[model samples]
Target: MGAIGRFTISLRLLLALTQMAAVGLGGAVHAVTQLSRTDTTYTRVLEQEAAGMVLVTRAGLHAHNDSRLLQSLFVERDMPARQRILGERDRAQRRFRDAIARAQDVLPKETAALDDIERHFETMFDSGQRIEAALLAGEDERALRMLQEERLPAFESFRRVAQTEVARLHRRMDEISEEATRKAERAWQVTLLTAVLAVLLALFLAAWLLRRTVIAPLDAVAARMRALEAGDDRAPVPGQERADEIGRMARALESFRLAAIERRRLGHEARTDALTGLLNRRALLETLETLAGGATPLLAIAIDLDHFKQANDTHGHATGDALLRAVAQRIRAALRAGDIAGRLGGDEFVVILAGTDEAAEAVAHRLRDTLNGPVEIEGRLLRLGATLGIAALPRDAGTPAGLLEAADQALIRAKRIGRGGVGRAAARAG
Candidate 1:
């Protein structure tokens, strides 16, 4: 009972633990998915900001080229070319500012570096304005000298600063990407560890449960079943020890086995004569009736111990019983293999010889000779004689009742003729 209780409790505990493990695995998978999504989002934002920063640096370099062209146009005194260069300068400046604004808005964390870039662009713009003023005042040489010393140097400084900032942003992006990769790797490692542990635990639990719930019980029941099939009803039943469904099945099998044994015992008793260990009257008649339909020829012989009643009256019933047992043994010894002999109450006996009736006369003579010679009971040596009547199947009679009637008639004839003589039935139509 204690073991049964533990089994029940252990089953529930295993189920609970399995559910918990599933929940933990699901949570770990969800965490990994969320981490991957977050990393992807951060990477996209960083890439967009980096692209915008590159656009701003390119625009600044274009504006510086436009400014240098504008000073050359002024020295050539080409009004149309100067006007186009000025317009290009304004468009480039506007494009540069717009790109910077977008980069700054997209990546607010890089504000300090953008501020320094903005400062360099402002210096370059101021230098360009001074060069344009010299051109408007017709100071060509002065403007050319200022272009080399002030505007050129200012534009170079702006370009250098923008490129430096762009490199810095790229380095920052690389750092962010590396950190995200490391984090993703760590999350995957944890998830894999948790999943592997859960699977191993589940396998162990399954194996344990199978052994307890199925394998052990089935093995025990199978052994008992094998014993039952082998006709060993006395084999010990182990299901009585178990408290599960297997135990109930074992109990049922045990009951069935006992019932089968009892049924066999009853059947044996019904067909057997308790006194001489031979077939009873009803069983002998049934055997003859069953043999009546078969194709093989069989002989039915009726036997009677001569003066049996006189012997019982003179020597007592105990002596008669001993005489009957001796006579039955002698009859059995005279019968060939496959011959069936039985007692038909009192001192009368019947024997059926299988295969043919060719040896019927010879067998009857043998039985008569066997019974005529023996008896030593209560220290008294008494000699006995037996009379036999032989009836051949399909020759003297066909039906069991006909055969028995004919054999009885023959026995009557033998008794009339003399004691201890063998008589054969008269022939009849098939």
Candidate 2:
């Protein structure tokens, strides 16, 4: 698949798995926490019910004592204390009933311990009512006897039953707590296992993807660089399918290598002049065109070697070619970086000077003076003179064709005036 497609697929899969894991973990944690909180609330209710039963037992004992005190003292003021004790007992019974209702909501269906506790509370209430009625009827001995014998026995048994019920509820609560603990431990184990597996899967996928996309490509480029350094141009490397920046870089490098080879081949052809190695007329025209279009003003100096036909007659065509090559080298050495110096075949050469005046007279004078330097041919130095024709851009003519023609006319003028002299082209009027 394509690089982007592969990345997207991997990313989507990872995201989906991650989301699923998160949801599962969240649900599990919430269930565990809820169960734990419910267990705590149920345990608190059982304790509260157990406390209410203890209060009911104490109030029953106090009622029995108040009945005994009423019989022994027979004071009218003791009636209020008796009433307060009865009221306390009633409140405790009410609290016990409320606690039982709360416990029913929490405990499992029809619990045996809860049933026993309810039965014990009913018996205790009936015994208390009988004792209270006998005392109110002024049957003091009968009421005391009933409380000491029947009611006290029932209350004691009720306390034992309530204690047993509390113990049973506590046992059930402990069981639930243990079960919840086991469930929480299991959840933790599962979560840990899932997290470890996820990490391992992520690492494996990351390594695999890195190898496929990045590492492999980098290795290929490294191998290519090594091969290039070892001069093995034929070495094969994987090319990019995408048009991204890396692909563009590879393409650019390939183009540069090809261009370098082509440049070496062209350099040989460029060195030789078709007509004479004196730089062809095509080369001269190209140089003049480049200078004319420049932002800086330029002077075009056209030089024609003096008495070339007579020298050819005296020596040979081979001697003329040698002289031209020597002159071309000398002129090239004398020029600056931006200057253009080239031959127009036969015995003619051109020099383009940047930043020259409109008159072109200054450039002509410099060239005539510099050309006075000797030319070395086959270890023999020859002193030769040349005539120069100068034309400045925008002053002579605006276009390349006009500039060349004007320079040629100036050269003709120099030859007509005198050999080895400088001439300038007249500036054209707007």
- Give the TM-score comparing model 1 with the true structure, all chains together: 0.50
Q: Which candidate achieves the best TM-score against the true structure?
A: 1
Scored against the true structure, residue 421 in model 1 reaches a CA lDDT of 90
Candidate 2, 285-401: lDDT as tens digits: 666665566688767788888866665557666666677676777677666666777665557778777775643465466666666667665665666678988877777878766
Cα deviation at 313, candidate 1, in Å, is 1.9
CA-RMSD of model 2:
49.7
RMSD of each: 51.0, 49.7
Sum up the clashes in candidate 1: 0
lDDT of each: 0.71, 0.58
